[model samples]
Target: MLSRRLISIAGAFSLALTITACGTTTRQQVGIGTGAVLGGVAGSAVTNGSTLGTVGGAAVGGVIGNEVAKKKK
Candidate 1:
């Protein structure tokens, strides 16, 4: 159970990173939008359908994505 939980957490982090990386070529606005949507879904799934987790994840993902996009430009 512990291992599974750890794996899940790691997977979520990796997915967030991958999404942010993919948006790096685009503008910050686009990145933030896409990241928020994707992150929301991922967060919901990871958190077992928690609304707060989804929202929080979306916000964080948006920021990270925007930063990445800005850096790439």
Candidate 2:
């Protein structure tokens, strides 16, 4: 039962990420979307579908991705 729920959550998250990623036109946008998707998946797995963990992971991942894709002088 729990496993099924986790799978469902992960699937939904993935779908949502894919949908959002479609509009990205820049490396940074792509990076953030990719990171958030990966992070959300990892977070869900680690926390067993805890909403806070998933959201926090996405937020953290977005920040990391933004930093990684940032233009440098």
Clash number for each model: 0, 0
TM-score of 1: 0.59
lDDT of 2 at 28: 81
User: By lDDT, who's the top model here?
Assistant: 2
* Candidate 2 Cα lDDT to native: 0.71
Q: What is the lDDT of residue 1 in candidate 2?
A: 42
Once model 1 is optimally superposed onto the true structure by TM-score, how far is the C-alpha of residue 72 displaced, in angstroms? 4.5
Give candidates' CA RMSD values in order: 7.0, 3.0
Colliding pairs, model 1: none
Task: List candidate 2 segments past 4 Å from native.
Answer: 1-24
Global lDDT of each model? 0.66, 0.71
**C-alpha TM-scores of all predictions:** 0.59, 0.69
Q: Choose the strongest candidate by TM-score.
A: 2
Output the lDDT of residue 16, model 1: 54
Model 1 Cα lDDT, one tens digit per residue, 1-73: 4454445455555655675566444566677766776677677677876667767777887887777778642
